[model samples]
Target: MGADNQFPVIQYVNEAGSLKQDEVKLHKEQLYQFYFMMVRARMMDKKCLNLQRQGRIGTYVQYEGQEAAQVGSALAVEDGDWMFPTYRDHAATMSFGHSLRNLFLYWKGRLEGSIPPEGRNIFPPAVPIASQLLHAAGAAWAEKKKNSDRVSIVYFGDGATSEGDFHEGLNFASVFHAPVVFFNQNNGYAISVPMEKQMKSKTIAQKGLAYDIPSLRIDGNDILAVYHETVKAVARARSGGGPTLIEAVTWRYGAHTTADDPSKYRDQQESEIRRKTTDPLLRVERLLKNQGWWKEEEKERMEAEITKEINQALKEAEKFKPADIDELFDHVFAEPVWPIEEQRKQHKRLSREGIQ
Candidate 1:
């Protein structure tokens, strides 16, 4: 048997926009909603890249190619479910009702961006890799103890599997029957290091076998597959079926972040090829066209609407004052530690004296 037989990639729609699974019914409204969110996310990612180039935001992470994986998995969860996203998962957070203005403010390095809207259990982006895995596990375990049906979904990259927290989180969740979905977007590259160089595992989904967590690998670019798989995982978690690990096989079409150069490490031509063949948005578009649900005028209207929404969010983000230097020290503890207090005082004195 080939790899396809060994590690099956769940997909409802083929590249030609034909339904591979006849049992799965395609809803026009649902398809339109998915397309809208994907387009919105793509637009936001492009705008942020431009903002970074113009020095309007700090180093920004782009999520252009992974929209279907992010948006589909996010939309699968319920309203009260907790979301632990990485810096590259603003697409997911935005789909889960995170504010666009707050996302922009995060790239601007403001602490306020970390705060989710009222009753939204979205954690700030975890920049330290797999650390959020443990947090997600703990939160899920807590909800389990509370006898609540809520589940936690934690997003991470392929590189995070190497971290100790990854194993610890899975082991704990398995032992305690925690309701958490470990969502891994295998985007082929961990920064400049390709997946082949990173690990010997044939598939990231197989990693969960050791912990006895139910796991599967799916075609991340197929929005229907992603959505269906995640819905099942969420349902399993809610029904006391314990943890799940989903490895969404996808690709990144750009540099790891705005600060990096992809040309140095990867063949740019490969990304171009993937863009033409495996783009997430294009797949949805093709499916829509195949189903006779696509309208050029509707797409144009969506673009205009999304552009206006993003521009308004950008304006709101820009209106915020520059972050105060001392505000960082104040949040470290309820009361500032002596060393931090001293450093804050010294920095303030230097600023007053106009000294470097």
Candidate 2:
């Protein structure tokens, strides 16, 4: 594709796997790392789906096709940076040093999943749409006040753009010149609601213009493009250039979540067709092939490594103690309210009577 003519669709590699070297500079190591992370994300997604089916996890949101968008932007941030992710963005969190066990524990409904590893600034996945945007802006603004160099990156869905928090966050960030990257994955739907029905704007990136923020829309499935663009955004923030909004034009090949049926709201056949041209991993594989880095042995080795890593994490997660019901009330407040105390007592009484 003629990328220059397509102002917002910056792509370094074509769907056929052909690379446009003039479009973006990349090293073999970076490409390989992208491939590794994408595969790992896919594996984790598949495993999570199976776990849900087996009743090992609660409802889950799958991000199989958007691996490139998640992993690329995730890898672009510094260790000190903050990450605000939605329920579908565990891949991004895991890519940024989050423990795989903790992620799985999250799906199992454990509070431990919310805790970030030491020195890692990762937040629990947000289920309330677009709420994280405000958190990201607030944290980044705080960082600026402390005269720290840390930036914050927030991820949201195309559907989230419609929320009031989205606009409020953008406005706050722009007014404060906060260091936040509003990474939007325009995956075409909010549940069954199509993008056209969701908004009238020509593009999500265009919405940033109203806030006087720098914005760009890119081929989110193109890992190179995502990495390069996010790196620039982060750099700009670090240098006090303020916030940016990046709309990653991507897709989710699976159902909105394991709980819903895609056929009920979307054309499943059309999704199958998207696998041909817009599948993130296939494009990266094509890139690898063109670079002469595609090897059967390497592929097998990577799969084995991923399998081992996931299995180990799964074991650890399973070995964890069952979550306490009281934990639900504990974290919400420093001191329990009367209603909460009464409920806790009721539960305790029920437990003693073996009726809980």
Candidate 3:
């Protein structure tokens, strides 16, 4: 199916900045905040890619074109809410108050990087794909049981929806009325497998219908739409309306990760085209201009400040010594089982032999 036949793209502002002009109760300050977050995210993504190239950080996942979807939904959550992110959703984690230094450390292969600051419930990125959905559903169910209004939001890619755990999670959440939002970023492809090859369903949002959950397909590039719709979904979840599934239709301008090349599977020209029209930052800039709140000077200043901040975070992350090889084996259990101890000793012997 072509992009147009997917669904009526949910949007509040056009690229030209002429708002639908209804009483949506949007404020200029809110729009500016969204714009700043998107810009910061884009800057961080670019920095990480460069750091990877410099051999400073490990392999990186760049979320260049998915800023609005991440920032918009992340900003909708309150401080007490829990966030479950995949390796590609760092923008959401950052917007939800995850430390930039820790994020950099995470890419640097430090386990400590996964630890959230005091009272923050951000989980480490789940690289095993949709496995985090079960955890999110369980956490939200426990919160519901405790009568707390806190909601849990889980981020996954379109490819993740095909995992058995995804269906299981939505089923469990629907049955238990768990306060969780399953944020599926339909970025056209899962690694190299396009959505059509990954699933038979025409639309990801429609997947939630099996479980009787409320779901919507939104134009993920539209920051305003992403934010408002997420705010409503989260509000509904908090008000005992159970889980909501949001399929944010967006694209990734870069390869799935630094380790892959897009030219191998798809056309790079499409990404270049996306840069012109569907770029998330451009849409926000368009909105700002429509409202006469955008300034070129302000954009340049913001970019400069963000670059400095990213550099400072990188410095902090690099200051820490590389993770101890043994530390990886020590954390799994209170008392290392005999099998683990044997493996650890074997690992040490191999290291002494200069095997790696």
Candidate 4:
């Protein structure tokens, strides 16, 4: 009942570093892309954490242990596909060609960070939890109406499933056959409340059954599995096959956010153990070694290259102009309402008097 039995966890590669099928050939370049992005995602997370500690940025959400779930699924989506991400899905957004400098700007609390690259239909990270699901469904429905092949992939955590919008999104997608993939990264806990404490549903995938949608559970740490399964889901959606709910059961090694301590609720040692046993990057490296394609020079070069890129982006983010005081009042509504106007005036007056 704890682990999904009905929707058995699908995996292409096992923890021991062996591919499930001998015929599943992979090119070195493809593997490198997967490895590089996963590493980049983790590195970005680490850099942001350090910046937050140094007061260079605001509190950050870490997605260290869930890189495979994010990066693999991200790579599965096509260039023109839409991406709806949660705050913790920087890996996905980055893999989908989001600007690294802008991603840095986001944690710095600047509005510029919210914008996606030109031609890349990436939505700003929805911090309000499952609200993005409704948006994804709506966007997919729009595409369907237009007779386009575009699909929307929305990322949400397990906790979001309990929200009313989750059901609403799924129901709408089901009834209308919206081409949206409900990608759920079930990272055991929703901030702090563990899955068992919140819902009795044995698995998140089964929730899709109620809506009569195809669903599956996958080993989120297995990058190959994540990529392959997601490719199928995305392809299905693009082909007008309706929505697919994918529950990637993964783990987070660090605290929920810089503001909270995971140790208070969960044992930190378990994370250390999981690092050796199920770390996504390590699994890929193992696969490379098993395939006799593991090259130290290639890895070293990648590390250097990615480090340079991340540092350059960080510098660029730091070069941005200081946030304007008026930004707080700019976008509350198209035409300013009295409450927003009143608050703006009050804030300006307080600032002029050297008060917060």
- Over 4 Å off, model 4: 1-3
User: What are the clashing pairs of model 4?
Assistant: none
Q: Write down the TM-score for model 3.
A: 0.96
Rank the candidate models, highest TM-score first. Answer: 4, 1, 3, 2
Q: Model 2 segments beyond 4 Å from truth?
A: 1-7, 21-23, 349-356
lDDT of candidate 2 over 1-356, digit per residue (tens): 33234345878788998877585665778788899999999999999999999999999999989999999999999999999999999889999999999999999899998888999999889999999999999999999999999999999999999999999999999999999999999889999999999888768888887899998899999898899899999999998999999999998999999879989889888878889987988998888888787887887899999999999999999998888887877867787789888888999999899996
lDDT for each candidate structure: 0.93, 0.91, 0.90, 0.94
Q: How far is each candidate from the true structure, as Cα RMSD in Å? A: 1.3, 2.4, 1.9, 1.3
Per-residue CA lDDT of model 1 for 1-356, tens digit only, reads 54446678898887778899989999999999999999999999999999999989989999899999999999999899999999999999999999999999998989989999998999999999899999999999999999999999999999999889999999999999999999999998899998899998878988898999998999999999999999999999999999999999998888899889999989999989988888999998999999899999999999999999999999999999998777878888887689998988899999899985
Candidate 3 residues lying further than 4 Å off, grouped into runs, are 1-7
Clashing pairs in 3: none
lDDT over C-alpha atoms for residue 350 of model 2 = 96
lDDT of 4 by residue, 229-342 (tens): 999999999998999999998999999999999988999999999999999999999999998999989889988999999999999999998788689799889998999999
Q: State TM-scores per candidate.
A: 0.97, 0.96, 0.96, 0.98
